[model samples]
Target: MLNMFNTALTALNANSTAIDVTGHNLANLNTSGYKAGTVSFEELVTQDLSVDSSDINGNGIGAPVLSRQFTNGTVQVTGGLLDAAISGNGFFTVQGSDGNTYYTRAGNFKLDDSGNLVTATGENVQGWMATNGVASPGGVPTNISIPPGSANAPVPSTFFGMNMNLNALGTVDGTNGTFTAPVEVVDSLGTKHTLTATFTKTDTNAWKYDISIDGGDVDGGTAGTPSSLATGTLTFDTNGKLTAPAADAGSVEISLPAFANGAGEQTVNWQLYDSAGASQVTQYGEASAVNSNSGDGSTAAQLTQVVMGDGGKVMAKYSNGTQKLVAVVALASIQNPDSLVAVGNNNYSTTPASGPVSYGEAGTGTRGGITANALESSNVDMARELTNIIIYQRSYQANARVITAGDEISQEILSLKR
Candidate 1:
């Protein structure tokens, strides 16, 4: 009888453990990025019973908490630049303001006071630093900012490449003759200058006059005569890469006026003057050009503004009206991601199990390139949790019933003895 009571007590304890495990799961059901725990039972081994090692195993006996169970949860989508989610097997590395490093799967981040990328709690985002094409891991990442008066310019080597399709039949009366546009150009010092081009119609199909850029121009022969820059015909191959210059090459090389400094991006005024008899104006927006049908084998983007592709790559315009690569963003990658330790707050740290960190771009390897204003969500499965809860409840009830029946039988035996 005493043995029976002990058996009942053990059953009660097991049931209680199941209840606690289920309760914990329910508590964290709504917790963000919480990996659900699994409660498993292991039967106690008894010397009297010769249990087969491979048959019953430990499934029939004791119940222990299995917190290490990893469930691929459902991810919730949130549109935010700071929100990030890992697609494969890695975690984000974070550094607290106190200089402590932590890791987690969560990727909610924001800009810190010093303009460094940081978490909501103000932890700094960790990654390798890049200068030019080379990169190295560092504690401080300089703020990414666009310099003021950046010299963003129009492209193509030969000036006045894309000439306006002049109306061969249209006539401009000298009384109201005008042609103007705001052209953005980089100066010898790499500064942005806005040049306002003015033109006057001189006669049919033929126009003449001075090209004043940013209010500056060279001697135009006689006071109002632009003999220095002679008028030229507009010729185009099927593909519009300009087959010819808009005006005749001058006796002296013409120096195209450009912006002043080279901090980064600049906006300029591009214009053409009609001094013949009529006035007209034109302007270019963010796009200098798109696709082009031209003699030059360059793509359409080369027809206007500088063209560029992904990463931190960009088409750079320099002083002296030149264009080149100004800057580019670098990406990094890793391996053995499963070994990464998860720190709270959606962060992860590389451990020995994870091996050495391998670097690559976002799209390279398992690290998918990032999308703006889009984030990966937590992987939590609600249906699975509900099912697990039901199983636990049944186990708890069975164990409680066993204990109650044992108590009744023990009472009957005690009464008989009395």
Candidate 2:
């Protein structure tokens, strides 16, 4: 009778624990990156009732074993600038406030006050930050920090290119003899200066070229006068193709002397041909026209926003419509991810059972690729959990009936003695 009671009690306890596991799963159905808990019943030790008869009887139900399901959940688009999600097997490396390293599947990250990438609970995200728009992710990763309001310094003009045709049929004495092309160039101090190129027809299929700037832009000169900086001659063939400036010859050089604005000396290269040896300056019979001209220079620009791009890249966008790859988020892959120990806040700590971690950039080795502007939802199934709840409830009720029957039988036996 005592054994019967013990068996029923064990069944009740196991059923109660299974019900608790189901409840926990249902409660966290909406939690981001939450893994569902699963329960499995185990049988206690059994003994042979009679050795000769070979009859084996089961003892009782033992406690249910609880395990976590590590299957990936559905990825949903969130449209957050910094939000990210893993598409396969991998975890984001992070450093918790406790000074311990952790991993997570959640990618809903934000920049803290100090511009450090961190989770909602303030855990620092680990990655390789770029220096001067270059990043090396092969090295050891540290906390990724991108200061807000950062700016990109201005770059002075070094190369100026133009694709235009000087008239081959124009005369040398009329107003058609001179053609001027004005382009804006930047000095070392990021000051804009207008440099003009004048072409004068000297003879048939021959022309004199002069590169000049404003006299006031120099150290000492008149404000309104145009100062010549360089002079050269352009000789074309009968086919209107440039011949004096040979194809093998390099770009025309323009040197700027000391400026009144205290800017240093600068040298700008005037390209007559493109990289593919295509002629940019031609003496065609068409009308003289400056079709296109450009200079490589920019003013200082402010940081506009930081965006999370695909493959775990962090891009810093500037107000000048330029983007720089500022950092790369690192990912970790474990052989046995199911063995990881959950430390709350959607993070998991490494354990001996988890095996060694393979850390690298996403889409490398066994690590998964990342999706920008998205989040991973919980893996809990509502219908499955609800059904589990009913199953455990029925089992618990059956165990209670056994206990009630045992109690009634004991009472009858006591009454027999009375």
Candidate 3:
């Protein structure tokens, strides 16, 4: 009779634990990146009924063990540039305020006042920084930040290439056949200057060219007046293809005077030949029109926006139409993620059973790729949890009935004394 009572009491305790676990799961159904907790009950050790008998019925129920379900949660789009989600297996490593490292699947990240990427609870996100628009792999991860009010310095114009048609039927003198092409170049100080190239037909199959800058003089030229920086002659074959001024001679080197604001002298290379060995300045039988012009330079620009890529790279877009890599978010993959210890705030700490952590860029090895502007939803299934609650409640009721019956039997036995 005592064994019966002990069995009922143990069963009730196990059932109670199951109810608590189910309640916990249901309560956190809406929690971001929350993995549901599951409970399992085992049979307690059995005892021998007698020395001569083989019967060994259990006397009590064993304790219930609680574990987390590591299954992936649904990913939801949040449309925030800094929001991120893992599409496969891995966790975003963050450093907590307590100076310990924790891993998480929740990607609701924000930029702190100091420009460091941090979780809602103020844990710093770790990543590699990019230098000069390029990121070097295999570096230790650190806090990723974007300096406020950052700006990209200007790049000076080094070369300019043009593709245009010079009228094939134009006059052979400066009287009726001259075309002026204006090209904009940037100096070391980010100042724009209009450099003009004048082409004059000298004779059949021949043309003379001169380059000048507006409001300035070429180096070694008369000051305060428009002066030619370079002069050369172009000759075309009977087939109307440029034949003279060989490829080596097709480029001109010119120097410009210092800017009023103390910028240093600028040197630019003017390319006349295209990659196809054809002169960009072709004397084809067509109207004198510029086809395309390209120059290598940029004015000063400010950082306007930052975006996260699928590969976990953060890129900064500038106002001058340039994009550069700012940092690469690192991910950690554990051999047994299910064994991680949950610390609060949707984070987990490494445990002895979790195995060694392997760190790498997302989408590489066992690490998962990143989905920007999104977050991972909780993995808890409300319907399943509700059903589990019903099952545990019924089991608890059955165990309670056993305790009630045991008490009534004990009372009946005690009544014999009356």
Candidate 4:
């Protein structure tokens, strides 16, 4: 009877552990990025009533959520520029204040005061530093600042490149031969300028040209006359990104306007009339600038008018007139991600069971990068947890009943003596 009581006691202990796991799951059911765990059981040792006893039952199984080590949850997208989600096997590394590395799946990152990109808790995000413009593994963990597009900085850009299609009149009046068309030029601030490319037909399919910009003689902007192409060569790419780099590109160095709002800013002043054309300058509206980029104070502005080249794309441009690319966020994958041990503070620590971290840029390989303005939700199933609760409660009660029955039998034995 005493041995039976011991067996019941062990069952109670196992059931109690299972109940604790259930409580944890219930508590974290609404947690963001939380993964629900499941319980598993292994049988305890069994007694054999035979001439020669055989070892059986080993360690008895109880309800266990520990077996549900990880969960694959659904992700929600918000479409914000800074929001990102990881679609495959990897962990985001964050450095805690304690100087230890912590991992996470949360991608809700923003720029903190120190200009470092950080999580909601201000844990710094990591990235590869660029060496000579080549991104490599040596980048120190640094914060990325939120960029607020400010005033157009003063920088000179020569005729960078321009793409345009022309309609030839086929036959030029030998007596009075001339043709006119518009060509675009971007200034130091990436403002576009329309230069009137002119051709005095020397022959069919060919013309000698002089350029007038914003209707002003751009030939005057440069000391020499605008050079004209005599032979064949004026094709455009589909999306408008140049198929070949634009050459000879003389450049125009336009100065910035002296206004905060830049309300009346123009890519350039231009008007091309068929010969008797009035000298008119072209300027963009307020909505164009606002929609084109975030302002200096980080205002949310919608881009209304989109400027396109041969194709349509408004790539990032910096103060130096150098192209700036929205940095591609990195992602890390693990062969056995479940092996990762969850540390507190919404982070995890890597264990050997998780294997090595495989690094790659987002949206590449089997791993995919997520858009901004989206987040991953918890994987806890309330119904499943409730079922676990019932099983644990019943098991606890059954174990307790076993002990009670054992005590009752003991009482009967004593009564027999009495």
How do the residues 125-216 of candidate 2 rate in per-residue lDDT, one tens digit apiece? 99898888888887567999998888887778998988889998799977578899998888877678899999999999999999999899
lDDT of 3 by residue, 1-418 (tens): 9889899899999999999989988888878788898988898867675654666778677999878898889999989888888988999889998888899988888888787889888999998899987876565678789986699888999999888878888887644478888988898877777888998999898988888875443334454676666788878887777777778776778787776555678889888797777688788877777899987888889988877777788888899898889998889889998788888898999889999887889988977789988888999999999999999999999989998998999999999999
Relative to the true structure, candidate 2 reaches a TM of 0.84
Q: What local lDDT does model 2 show for residue 297?
A: 82
Q: Write the per-residue lDDT of candidate 1 for residues 148-264, one digit (tens) a residue.
A: 334433332223322343333333674434555444433333233433434455554344434344323222223333322223333333333223333232111235532222333
What C-alpha root-mean-square deviation, in Å, does candidate 3 show against the real structure?
Answer: 3.5
TM-score on alpha carbons, each prediction: 0.58, 0.84, 0.84, 0.62
Regarding lDDT, does 1 or 4 come out ahead? Answer: 4
For residues 1-418, could you state the per-residue lDDT of candidate 4 as single tens digits?
6768777787888888888878888898656566565656666666676635765533444444364455556777655445555555555667777777677777767666554567778877665533323444423333333244423243322322222222343345553345455554444443444445464545544445455443132322333344332222222233322221132322223332322223232333111211233211111111101111111111122222211111001123443434423233456667776666777656777787877676655555666555455666667777888988898899899989988999999999999987
Q: Highest lDDT: which candidate?
A: 2
| Model 1: residues with Cα > 4 Å off, grouped in runs | 1-25, 48-77, 97-100, 129-163, 170-178, 186-192, 198-210, 214-242, 246-343, 346-359, 408-418
Error of 2 at 39 (Å): 2.7
- State each model's CA lDDT, in order: 0.44, 0.88, 0.84, 0.50
Alpha carbon deviation, residue 132, candidate 1 (Å): 7.2
Residue pairs whose backbone atoms clash in candidate 2: none
